[model samples]
Target: MSSRQRGNFNYKLAFKLFSSFFFLSAIMDVLAEANGIFALNLLKTLGKDNSKNVFFSPMSMSCALAMVYMGAKGNTAAQMAQVLSFNKSGGGGDIHQGFQSLLTEVNKTGTQYLLRMANRLFGEKSCDFLSSFRDSCQKFYQAEMEELDFISAVEKSRKHINTWVAEKTEGKIAELLSPGSVDPLTRLVLVNAVYFKGNWNEQFDKENTEERLFKVSKNEEKPVQMMFKQSTFKKTYIGEIFTQILVLPYVGKELNMIIMLPDETTDLRTVEKELTYEKFVEWTRLDMMDEEEVEVSLPRFKLEESYDMESVLCSLGMTDAFELGKADFSGMSQTDLSLSKVVHKSFVEVNEEGTEAAAATAAIMMMRCARFFPRFCADHPFLFFIQHSKTNGILFCGRFSSP
Candidate 1:
């Protein structure tokens, strides 16, 4: 319950947090355009039918353009919702460059994740998807570099990015970034926000999981299966949410895979929806329970996914942000400018006790599928997810039935 409220609160918080970073004009234009491109890519990946998922909030595959361009030159995040127009860059940086760079990065990281995951899990499917996205993403990034202003461009990108990510993620990830979230001692704080989630092709067994009473909320208790497992892991019990979060560290401790199991009567999906970066971080710092009784369910599932946002933006009428001829970036440099790319990457895998996921955003083009009825006899509801402890990002979201 608290997590949900917090998630709702973060929506406004995201707007306020990065609002001050850049001038209104700069932030609005760049972020809006980038978000559109992001949406377009989704059409490319999942197809037009899935538009509702990428367009709306909560369960939406969406993003905001936010970043701080820091080059030897000065930078700025303009105020105002609509983007300001700039002189055509004979070759100078363009409005789209920042978003292009952002998308490019998103696509690059997403591809890397898909490839690595395919090699380990998906195999041939990974190769298939990679082949499809490679050309598109590269072309997008190449386009962004056509006009580049290192510093100002970064500022325009970063300003709204933090806010965009914070809003999309529901604050599960306060800072959608790593060491750079709080850039050194510099007065300027540049944050990159990332929110991603996916469901399994298979789900865990609800019947197989032991159903027992759980301490759901501060005021309630109900029957719930506390998924159990004996594994070397990290976990935290959140008093606010009345749940215990278990962290299953991935290959490189840098990416932490986690699970949120509510006290009895608590809804896993409810808890999942309410997750935030602030709350997630708090969960991680918790003291570990080396050995304890837990109710666990194993789900048989897998998820295949990817996205692009160019067309979505075009639909929004931010044409100038994507093209060199149409884009505007004159404010940054005295010369011409054009967007290179705006990229984003996301991945998640889920099982009974928890999940594993990773996400990144760049300005290059970035980029997913699904279905199955199993013959297994496992009957019951199971829980699973992949969460980024640092940013509270849900890579994949799902529930399993073992009936």
Candidate 2:
């Protein structure tokens, strides 16, 4: 070829590569924001009563639903897509590919931390799933297709799946499929498990920890094991909203915990109501935070939470997928099978060493901070989430009100 032609070819190749990178990066942002929104919405549902502590892994739940969406057809697909923000993408193919890339990205562990995520599909041995569906799951989600005798051995099948989940999560989660959660009528199940353990880049001294008062409400207070540390960190304080954010990085810069606390006089509900995908992005950006040396006091606590997600998803406009006759998952199987229930369980422990957490969610389906040397004391109710910095993937999110 001519020299000019070769030069033009090189330029075109470089441009295509650049464009692909740009596109993927944009999609990652969209997925991150969507995950954040889902997290907040789920919390809203679980906390509507506002009398209990709430916790779960939004990423795990989203991954499980995304797999379910793979088989969804017609209106069933439409509703799931809309609720999941997958409709913002070009199409189902792109969304699945984005999730595929994401699952791979976030699961890659750095030298300083362990982050593991796995997806699986469990179906009755008698059921026949489409080869295309199984292939897509294996390709996009790296999900294994396992056959169980849910028909003749309901209890055994439930125990087997629960054991698999526990093993995947290092035994941090167990009995995900409660007794009576599975029955002879159960035909298919989709599940995802995520486990993460990361150490603080700068560890808090054990000697500084002490029992401190944690204000649960206007009139209630409880003593908590509050961990104290003073260091230079990245932090953001919003005067208008009366919220403070702190970013605490793990040993590697790949992951970090972001904490959001309302002002002393402000209730957490005020900040929660204003949390949106746009606002989450705006708050986490580097430009929003200032570097300073400040004192930090955080509670050392462990929590476990479980939920029957069937009603929750239905209320979120995912009704068709859970309804027997209305459900259309033709792409997944040729049989007359629809989601009966979805269950989620998660456990989290945060201490001076860092954080260890695991979460499991079944589509029985139908399916931080901050830097500051500025005295950021988390002695009251506050919201916190662990995220992958590169992909902005929210691993786990929760609120600590009392202890």
Candidate 3:
């Protein structure tokens, strides 16, 4: 081959490889952002009373549903793909591959922090899942297929799955399936669990921790153990009148907590309304913040929340998956089976040292920014997210309203 031709060939090869990587990365981002929107919408639905605290893992729920989507056919697949933000750019196959790539990237060991994500498929012994579907799930989602006697021993099967979840999440999450959550009619269950433990890149001073008043509402105030720290971190100003954002990294830069504190006078509802997946991306961009000295006062709080997500997901346009006759999961099994229920539970604790979190989701059948000089005192109702910085995957998101 001529030298000019060889050079052109090399250039084309490099471009193709780069584009491939970029394409997969982009799809991961889309899935992550779509999960964010789903989280917000669900939170809105769950918090219609607007007084209760909200917390859960969007990533855990998404991972479990994505596994189900792999077996979904026709409109069932399309609705899920849309709700989960699975783009059709590379079609279905590439979408699953992208999830695999992103999962591998996030779960790769060797960091100062610990993050473990796992999935499992628990099916009744009588049901025969497609070989191709089983292989794809194991290959892409790292989920192992297990047979449980859900038909004869529903409670035993539920306990077994919940125990597995607790083990995977380091016991932070327990009792993912409540009594009667899994019944004799249940044939298949999919579960995903994620656990994270990390020390702060800059730890808050234990000596500086003290009781501070937290404004839960216009009329209610309660004392909370507020942790304090002073460090140079990324900061930005965002949303309504005077909302501020701060990014706090854990020991490993791979994962970080993004906090959005609205002004004392402004209600958190304002912040919630303005939060969208696209806006979240825009606010978290590295370019949005310049390193500056920030005095942070955050409450040391633990939140645990559980939700039966059947109706929540249906409201989000994923109706067909849960319907017995309407659902199409032919790709999974020749015998007709549809999703029965979805349950999710999450736990998060933040203290002077850092943060530890865990979440679990089981499907029985169906599926920020501030200014430079500003001090961030999370003493009022505020929004926060613990996210994987690389893939922009939100592990846990919440609004802290009360002590």
Candidate 4:
């Protein structure tokens, strides 16, 4: 197949694998509307052309990381030019070719970041999708490194990812990714594409942002400039653990974020681990955060992060694509060879206007909430979980967001 065809095939393979681990049945109670919407949004942001079901673009990647589908254009041709200017901190993008050459170079250059792609390919399922995309990919990744400190192969991957992100968001997003994750000895680079865009969903009317007494946990309350918004929203419920959910949308109606809190006390820190699509659905039903006259106050902040997937992917059970001695990467090298390496990273940010959310969630919401007997107020630190329902795994299980 042609290079673009190969890239497309690889992306599909990876996505399908990503889907299996995530939500294989969108309508079978396996995926939530948020995940479905996010999936569609991702395709729309990347390139959704019905004609070219399998075409390569700046918005597609062969494989890597937590199987998080940050973004992709189904069939439309990717706009390579637009990626140069988007300065939006919450998004990222990339594109690359010559899978074999790149992997070889990364292995030679990234000498200090080995052990990054730990388990490699344990519960891999993208084997088929990648083949359809005409690309070969597997998970073997870890967190990203700081810029200015990137090794050659890592820098190259960053270049491609940023290129796509900048072009896609019209420079609204910047290059916030690096590669110092694995050892240089096994730093194998591969062809791939990835992007993340987290803008403000509610967009705390910056003009209306006010300093409110932000209750942390039991006895901690700090005056924080909280962003406030009033709107009819989608809801979810967590059982007795304590909390209700609010699904807010952004400008395009393609992306969103889920916020959860306890019923009586917003002890966010204690319940971060229990937040998920299933739990949210359960919590929203049992607990109601949207009480009558329920005015919501949130924060306004943005975190643009990029990390290597080598380690995390392995941790999630994907281990076969990185073994140079036992790998089967002839598709990339055109020769009998062991799998070299695969590096994948992404960028994401959560802001006030809305959330330009990207890939992955790490269950870590730590806060406390204070509420009265019958009122449902999420005004405290409660578990904040971000899930990709597709994989049923939390892409972002943290405890923070702004108005």
Top TM-score model:
2
Residue lDDT tens for model 4, 1-403: 9999999999999999987634323222222333322332222232222211111111123223212221122111112112211112112322112222223333343232111111122111212223322322331222221122123354555565455545544454445334443332422334233333444443445666777775554556767666665444666555656566676544444334566666644444335434343444555442355533234676544433333434433442334444444444433333333223443333344445443231111011111243332223445554344433223322333334222
**Model 3 / residue 124 / CA error / Å:** 1.9
TM-score of every prediction relative to native: 0.34, 0.91, 0.89, 0.47
In candidate 3, how many Å is residue 68 off?
0.4
Q: List, residue by residue over 280-342, the lDDT tens digit for candidate 2.
A: 878888666898876789999888888888888888898998777899999888887788767
Error of 2 at 318 (Å): 0.4
**Which regions of candidate 2 are displaced past 4 Å?**
1-9, 354-373
Candidate 4 structure, TM-score to reference: 0.47
* Cα lDDT listed for each candidate: 0.34, 0.81, 0.79, 0.37
Q: What lDDT tens digits, residue by residue, belong to model 3 across residues 139-187?
A: 9887877888988888889999999999988887788888988899997
C-alpha-based local distance difference test score of model 3: 0.79
lDDT ranking from best candidate downward: 2, 3, 4, 1
Angstrom error of the Cα, residue 149, model 1: value is 22
Sorted on TM-score, best first, the list reads 2, 3, 4, 1
Q: Model 1: residues >4 Å from true position, as ranges?
A: 1-229, 268-274, 286-295, 306-328, 331-403
Model 2 / residue 280 / CA error / Å = 1.6
